[model samples]
Target: MNLPFNLSPWRTKLRLRSEAKAQVTARGSSRKKAPIKLGLPIFMMIVAVLCGLIMGLGSIQYAILIVAIIVAPLVLLMQSTTLIAWLLVVSMIVAGCLQYFARVEQAHWMPFLILAVMLARVPLDAMRAAKPGERSDGVDLLGFLLIAFVVLVFASALVNKNPPMQALVGVKQYVFPLALTAAVTLAVAPREFWLKVWRSIPWFLIAQLPLCLYQYLFVEKGTSTAFGATGIAWDAVVGSFGGNPEGGGASGALALFLCFGIASNLALLRSQQISPRLAWLSNAAAMASIFLAEVKVVVIFLPLALLILNRAKVLKSAVSAAAWLLATLAFVVGLLLVYQVLHYSNKQTGSKSLSEIFEFATKAEQDTYTYNRETGELSRTGALKTWSQENIGRGRLVESLVGYGPAASKGFSSMFGKGTVARKYVFQLQTSSASTVLWDLGVVGGGLVAAIFVLAFVRSLSLAKRLAADPPLSALAESCAVAIALTGSGYLYNNASVNVSSVQLLASLAIGMVFVLTRFAKKQAFLPAVSSQVKVVKRQVFRPRIGT
Candidate 1:
């Protein structure tokens, strides 16, 4: 090497120095390129300012415009995979508008129209999309049970020569099943999409609250009319049912809203992505609105909710129970105060004093209680019993099975009836939709139908319970299932099932979405997985160097 003038050592040294320099330069560049992190307070301030701006400019029309500008493009960008989800969202918006503005009769067209649009797209998009495997066998089994029940009910109507069988068929077979299917389909969509929809629900409820309040305080007259019409004579100011106040029903709606609000609050609270302050505000608003709704049934249900919240471990059982009890007592005291004020005002106006009103209410309650006790009558509970006894049994017969051959002559009719026999039966039976189910189908048909309904209810309840046990699924599934159960219970007497109005359709759709989503929740553990993985990665990255 000496003989070669020692050039090899110098060359090797130069190469080593150059490589070290290059490595240093690369490291420096990467340090410069790293993202700048904003402080939490500053970030939150910016967000708050933006939200304030948006809210200050709030008008539904303005909101819609902004949403269209922002969301429409985003939706389009994701159209390839999310077209159906977008369509469902659009349908909901339309349904909401119809519910707010349209008459009951006019509302029927909205869902059908939406369905038509959906069908048109189905050929191009929904059908062509790689279908997920046939959903859980459980859902299929459920569908079969529902279909069988409808068949049985229709059969009963036929045997009884009930003229209203057509309505029943339309509801049980077409409307309800479709609603359920749609819900399930929507549920299988991405979590982000469903969450977006969920967020919108509270807003929708809020919007309705003012109108409902107005109806309760001003528009509703005492006497009941179809479609919430105000009768000529105004009665006591109770809220929705103006004159002859259906305080119970109004309370039911309020209770429902409370349930929804509570669910929403729980969801927001558990959402790591959302701010804690925002969650608190939402929870507060929901609670306040529920209080204003003044539904007495909540007195019974609040404890149940507290128990649930505790069971879910979202809250401390002891603290939550104490808080709930105090709140209930406060609510009762508040109601009494309000009632006293109203009662005194009425008396001062030369009407019965508040005490007199209370006495009258007490008397009526006692009368109802006494009658039920003396005669073994069911009281409020009798409605379901009556429906079962009168209608459920008729659906089991043979001739009525395939729906009594639609439009066939049946007994008792009105101008709406098909034949003399149909007219006679209609008049004799007062064949409204509720009564017609039994009158037309007979006991066998109705009983089978009833059994199917029972099965569906049981399935929904069971699934809901299972979902509630899973932290991830509990929020959406519990809310949706409870809503469906409540609505279904109402239908036992109200005939909401047979009606094809917009509100009814929207409600059914919502329920169906819940069912579908809850079922899908069983397979979803992605969030939990991602969260754990993030924690592991964070821990590894932040681990102390061996020699810092």
Candidate 2:
């Protein structure tokens, strides 16, 4: 009836341990039982209902809904094979063609839907494969950027005179949060998803080709109401090209797609596993889109693509060099042809000829000469300086640094006596590419933000280079990176900060993915001891040798 003095404490401790073990066992049983009886079936039913709704919709709606549904799963499938990647390539082509045919919004949404779906697959796949200790640092970085962006928005709100900074706050909150989510989700995606995303690029351009052709042939002379309803006179008929003097509006986007496609095709051509016909088709479509877009700067992508191609060993040294040289010459000739066509067209329309166009383009020079003739000294140069003077420093250094609140600079500058000069000038230099970074953030803020942006790009490029040695994902990453870079350059004047451009959004997302992947890859290289142990066990379980 009596236990030993020392054994009494031991029995109590044993009883406590037994109780704890039973509780742990009960919790484990409940956790295991709950998912089987409720969670999985509920999830499956929801998916089924969603699918049913998508399928029941009309063709257009169904198409859109289906794309949205498929994107996440397809992105998850990226690491398995090149098929999904190729599917995306086709989707992109279809989207492009739609855009070219004046279905601008549809074109924007189609590829976006596909890319989004593909991106969604990434997080699912990552969750499936990720170990306990292998945290996604990319997500952390995205979170940090989101926080910084929010802080900047509030900071800008405080300093500006505009009361509508609140509205701007709303926009920042929506876009950056979504962007951050998308980027983080995509970063952890499997390599296969990235490949499928790349494969879709060629198809995207192919789709756009017809749209561009349609615009060039039929829509060139017509002007549509902006934002779908409001009536406004649009005298400018820029065609598929979005907004360069020589028809380059959509040119940047088209060119970026083409560059990525071309690079990917060349890489594929080297692989005996891929059919030559597919490669030829992809390359042809890419070239045609670039030619049709007619952006002079697109020529820059050729060399960059070639450099990537050569570095990836997709092409031999001599072949890459020769191809690059030919591309350069072709681009120059194409530009000249474009100029001549514009010149001749102007003359036929009783407008200015080549010389007159040049004179117009160089009006600032003429203005300077006239000013000097009158005052015997050169007037302040550069569009920024000229605009600054005219506006009487409305967008002064302080305003530039902190931004003129939100709605303050939304309208044209009244103080300049220039009537309305297009609110774009407030955040974008008129002569420079349409970029808000410089205008909104000024030199210092813009530079700092840009440096962070560029760092992300550089890291992606480096990762792409390293992955290039692997073939499957390398071509995909390289192509996507190049496309994003080409697209980013055009934003110099377009106020990409506003999230108005789908291409800009895509570029930002792609860059975010790259940054995330780079961080993940670096961390993987230095796994902790516990992670290494888990990895060893995983490898053994997953990668059994033949006859083992």
Candidate 3:
């Protein structure tokens, strides 16, 4: 990445060198710039819009407006790919939040904006890299496998009769996450670009976490409508991304991602790349997320991640983790103590004044699984029950082996079971990413998922250890290590670990950073970037006399 030799620091010399080269290039070159022809695509898109309106597809004027809003800004900002990329990330992260606040109809198109920006950069990234004789990272084989999986899901959904659009919509959501990976691998280059992305994680956390908290606290009380998501009911936590009646939306899962981001902060601190105060504050917020947003999975995963990180300052991490635990316990105690203090009596239940808040969370957690004290048997409920009844319990060998295809599992759980208990479990077709792959993609899907897990786990761990020998790369290395672990754990629970745009963007950037670090792994802190041979040669011809 460094120059072959040191050029003088003189700005005058550099300016003259640039001027002479421009004159020579103007005289020698006959090449003309190519015109960008966007007319055909524009025309086709308009035609499609018209056809949709003619065909009674609800006019699609809003859809066109959305597309225009996304496309116009991108075309204007095409020269600023990195800016566009960051903007896209911001848009994706905030769209749900915006939807919650403004009550916007559909915020999903934001991810498409993100994808369009990603695709647009492919050419520009290639051009910048070409001068140095570098080619793209190219689509990795795992990327191919992931894409194939998407095709299978989409194809399956397309042929199904039950609201096929919904099925496609569900399946399409899965792609944006992986699309992040493809975009990162394809476009990310040079140390500066990589570091910019590495550092951007904390910014994203700082920007989004507060908005999430605000919505959870002050905003949730305003109206019956949940602030960030639908169906949160009154007094539920504002966990819009993973909103249910309780569990405070998906805050706990997001907090877990902050935990992962803190790993990066630790790395940057070691390398002296970022300020210590920023690192500490960001890590503090990460610790707070567990308490502010309650989820059992966060309770399980946070400690495991810290243990894996196994920093030199064990006491420091332990204290942070302890504080998180204490805060969470305090919040629970406060919730209960206040409810007791109020002491309102409900005539229906024998118990006195059980808060609807507590009731919902308790039921949400218990509704899916029942433990028998006598036999030590646990009955399944919720998404598990759905998977069990349709794909597992009654499915024929072929269907079980392959799955009913995408959201087709949804129909299997459409009605209640014979009794109330059985029916409760059969409420919906909700399943984990792992479960879906296993049940829907069948044996082939299982094989693909397994291959991805084993490869990413082994490779990332190996890379982390190697890079940890140095301080700067350590940050990147550990981030990847944690992401790999998180990704593996997602097999059992979808949790948007690798299934949503915002998280996927982070995970993909982590994968991309790993690739960059691997290249510069034991090298010096900085490398001088040199120009192409053609530019260097052109600069040499314009040497001015020193007498003047």
Candidate 4:
């Protein structure tokens, strides 16, 4: 057949691209034709506010719910991935303060609400135009992993007959962040948009310095006296991770953020992306905040994070190894010195050396396995111990498999008129995220969650290698890999995941970005192959017109 051109080879791609453009045009025209109406939305907002006021009698928690109801729909309608990214960042930085000021219980639900909206928009993504190779980007495995975990949560809840409200609260803490991977997988955008989102993280971290300083200097340390919170001092030096005015604040959460800040800055510094001066300044602020917060976990998590983030690069360069080693030593000594100085006035361990303090902390941690009936504080070890005693020791096979019920292991007092595992044991189950997952979701659910983390880390690491040509993106993917490791380790260290702490939120954002980049990497890989194939086709079709 004599043909003017061979269109068969590129027909599919061209057709898909044209169809995507048409879909976008149609959607835009439809929006212009039927502009959004404010009347019904305004009425809904009023109803939400009135319902909130009546439900909680003007309490802040209900007020937040009202805001969630009003904001979520509008955000979904706007359908700006950039706006969604910013909201996640802003909410992570300040949601704690909002919770503290409003005196709401649990991690601020606003971030979770925002995430839910992102997930809901996934279906609409099909209707929206997508870039080349975005329709399938190797994140299907990650998405399936997350969805399976969620299904496990629901199944466990149903099998154990968990209260609906209680089950939902548990799901929010355990499953929402994992769901973020699926949300971001389909919700793809330009690389610059994602980079801008990451660039804002440092500024937000710097903003916390002022708030931490104020809390340390002016606030009298104690537990929150807010309406629902009257326990640990959750306000002091918590930075934007707010709590009550007279309380100690979210020291654990803040410390986790500081640890990430230090690691991230160091990573950027190693990559030569930022000036050493700026990196040092940011690390100093984070270290100082760690001292003010007085969280000991940083001593462990920071070193591990640095090692994971820099090992590959450091191994290739002797200078990098030396620089990293020196920096690690400096951070360690500075952290210990600052922590010792802050606690010098306390009689118990004020005079102890860094070595002695470490020894004491180690011993105290090791001894926490046996429940302290006198204090009722459930340390991580204690939580695991107690879980084993009640389930394995007593041979409660059914309960061991599916758990007592969802939210059954939480520390909160029962809102429903029923006994919960936490209440029955009179121990704070929220102290250890690992134990909470084990006791609440049981064996199958916990395994699924672990699998999600493992798969996410593996995929991120692979993506990092694939994006080696793009240093910024490569570093970001490696950072996500490290974040996933830290987040999983957090289950052993504290209830960061169970409480929806800033660390978990930050890790979720990193994982989502990694998945988004996976799509980008796939697209990049496709173009080069397509170009070579097109050249081959041209050679075959127009080969040296023999007569010429």
Top-scoring candidate (TM-score) = 4
| Model 1 C-alpha lDDT per residue in residues 260-334, reported as the tens digit of each score | 455555654564434566556655555554544544445444544444444444355777667766876886667
Question: After superposing candidate 4, which stretches have Cα over 4 Å from the reference?
Answer: 1-67, 80-83, 101-107, 126-139, 220-235, 245-247, 266-280, 313-330, 346-357, 368-375, 413-419, 538-548
> Candidate 3, residues 1-548: lDDT per residue as tens digits?
68888666677798999999999998778667779999979976886676567447664435656555546655535544354365446544666564455544345456655665555555665564454764445656655666676676666455433354545444544554554555555453566666666677666556556765655455333334443333222323333343333323444346557667777777677788789888887777655544444444554465556655664445467686677567656655664554444222323323335466567546755776544444332322444554556656764565555555554433232222122122233332333556555445556666766776566656666666666656656666776777667756755554354344555555555555555565575343223223455567777887676888
Q: Which candidate, 1 or 3, has the higher TM-score?
A: 3
RMSD, every candidate, angstroms: 14.6, 16.4, 13.0, 12.0
Model 3 TM-score on a 0 to 1 scale: 0.63
Give the range where candidate 4 is weakest over 10 consecutive residues by summed lDDT.
Answer: 226-235
Off by over 4 Å in 2: 1-147, 161-166, 169-174, 177-181, 184-188, 221-252, 267-275, 304-327, 338-346, 350-383, 386-397, 406-435, 493-500, 519-548
- lDDT at position 6, candidate 2: 62
lDDT of each: 0.45, 0.49, 0.54, 0.70
- Candidate 3 RMSD to the real structure: 13.0
Candidate 4 at residue 230, lDDT? 26
Candidate 3 — which pairs collide?
A: 2-528, 239-248, 239-249, 239-250, 368-381, 417-423
The C-alpha TM-scores of every prediction are 0.53, 0.58, 0.63, 0.79
* Model 2 Cα lDDT, one tens digit per residue, 31-133: 8444446866787677667766765763455555654564455454555234234333433344444444344444445444544454445456556656798
Q: Which residue runs of candidate 1 sit more than 4 Å off their true CA positions? A: 1-105, 112-140, 153-177, 186-188, 216-255, 272-295, 298-309, 312-472, 489-515, 518-548
Model 4: per-residue Cα lDDT over 1-548, one tens digit each: 88999878799889999999999999898884667789977887787768666666746556657667766777778655755665566466657777555555544666777767666776776457455654433337667776777777788788878777777776776677655655555564677766656555566667778777756555523223334332223335677775666544566777776777677776566566667877787777776677777677787778777787767877778998898888878877787787666643444422556678788667767886645575566667777877888888999998887787667777663345333677676656656788888888777767877887898888888988898878877777877877787787888877766675466667677777766787679778988999999999999998877665
**Candidate 2 worst ten-residue window by lDDT:** 229-238
